[model samples]
Target: MTAKYLVTGASGKLGQSVLRHLTETYQVAPGDIIAGSRKPETLSEWVAKGIQTRVVDFDDAASMEKAFAEAGRVLIISTDALDRPGHRLIQHKAAIAAAEKAGVQHLLYTSMPEPANSPLLFAPDHEGTEAAIKASTIPAWTILRNNWYFENVFLSASSALASGHWYSAAAGGGIAHILRDDIGRAVAAALVAPTEGKTVYTLTGTKAYSHADIAALIGAAAGKKISVVEVPLEGLVQGMVGAGLPEPLARVFASVDTMIGVGGLAKVTADYKTLTGLEPQGFEAWVDSQAAAFNALVK
Candidate 1:
């Protein structure tokens, strides 16, 4: 079956949610969707549902070509190679090249919010990928600049719940954290709808919250006292390193906090609602929903 939509990185969390939305919510035929991943065998459940599965390694130009051969629209989920600098950009360029060679008409990319100016160390990869997508021959493209995911805060929140202390460098900055599932729904909606030319959407929660505010919400939900301590950027990085995090990932965490402190993730947009016709979950509500996780952390 010829796939009308192709989703790269199909084994990842975001990819799985997007595929679910396409099949369950948007009602796209399973056979009309192709799930692409480096390890196609891991997508057996999707294949069993009549969805086509193909190997699409960004590093392998030939694999990308085969994966995109029969796809009308392709979604290039950004690769998870943040630790290795410059490697992700190379992979993204290769994907774009293969997509062009396959004559794919429409391309969609999952990018971070304000990559061009984000303080995050991995911002260059997204920024470069967006530029490559624009420079590609694909006639139509949509760029979803997704905000920080609430799921990302789990590690910190869990640690705080266990230790009763939350450390950060985001002094007064606010982050409009959106759920990964919400991003998936919005991406699925965009792919199913009729789009023309180049379009950009900033996908974020309706509201933004500071680290202290988030900690309060977590504290309330977990029925524990959690104090957020604002530290210096260097101190945060050192703390992370002391906690056994690798230097590269520790640096990423510290840089992200610094970015947040400078208002990098503070933008709240209605693009998610505009695309999906639904309001996004707020930070407080999301924290409440994940109460079990927080509770478990303390237990």
Candidate 2:
């Protein structure tokens, strides 16, 4: 029998990749999958093709409970509420409550690397959610404690290249940056395999690199000299303000830098290889891809 899988945030990049991976590799029957979110109608094609979807807003407990009505296993992608600080715990608590009430057999979560010491100021949000999952009445749970995604670098790099500035407080600290797609694929693997109880996996790449090294790669990719500039926490906050980032975001970013400076993001291990049984893509390879994209902009 095909197992039912509910993927929260189905419209997101990670969520979409999970769905595609399951369909293409796992051959999961479309009818056995449920994509829960605020706007289920947006995923009509997936539903039409047999994947079910339902409205499940984290803020609304009743709505979330209803969404899991027919789901046996659920992957609750963390909410995007970093700016508000305490909102994540609230949202996740609702999901956990609903999942427990609905008797969902297994639950999965996407978390950050070494969440206990993550440099991201948003780590509290992730930590709180993980704690709630740990304390939940759900029969089983899995936390994919993913490291910094190579894709996360790409996000800031695109804007940095456009603005001619690469900024960070991670001066000499290195992080094992795994591809976000790999995280998605890993989640799909975990969900497909039947396992019970709550466990946390620290997902990272086979290698690690510092921000300065990353800046150098970005420079090479764009065919221009890009330098890594590390600033003090206060200076970083000021820079963010100068760049028009909101006050709350600026402070959060600055605090995250302080965490990086203290080595929160530099931890690495063989966990990625152990979990996926495959070597991850390298930083240079990611740079080459970015170079290709930048070159295309000229064409």
**Model 2: number of backbone collisions:** 0
The whole-model C-alpha lDDT of candidate 1 against the native structure comes to 0.91
Task: Give lDDT per model, in order.
Answer: 0.91, 0.79
Query: How many steric overlaps does candidate 1 have?
Result: 0
What's each prediction's TM-score?
Answer: 0.98, 0.92
lDDT of 2 by residue, 198-271 (tens): 77888877667887777777777777665677777778788888889998988986776676667776677666
Encode model 1's per-residue lDDT on 109-184: one tens digit a residue: 9998888877889898999999999988889999999998989889788889999899988988899999999999
Best by TM-score: 1
Q: What is the lDDT of residue 174 in candidate 2?
A: 77
Return the clash pairs for model 1, or none: none
The best candidate by lDDT is: 1
RMSD of 2: 2.3
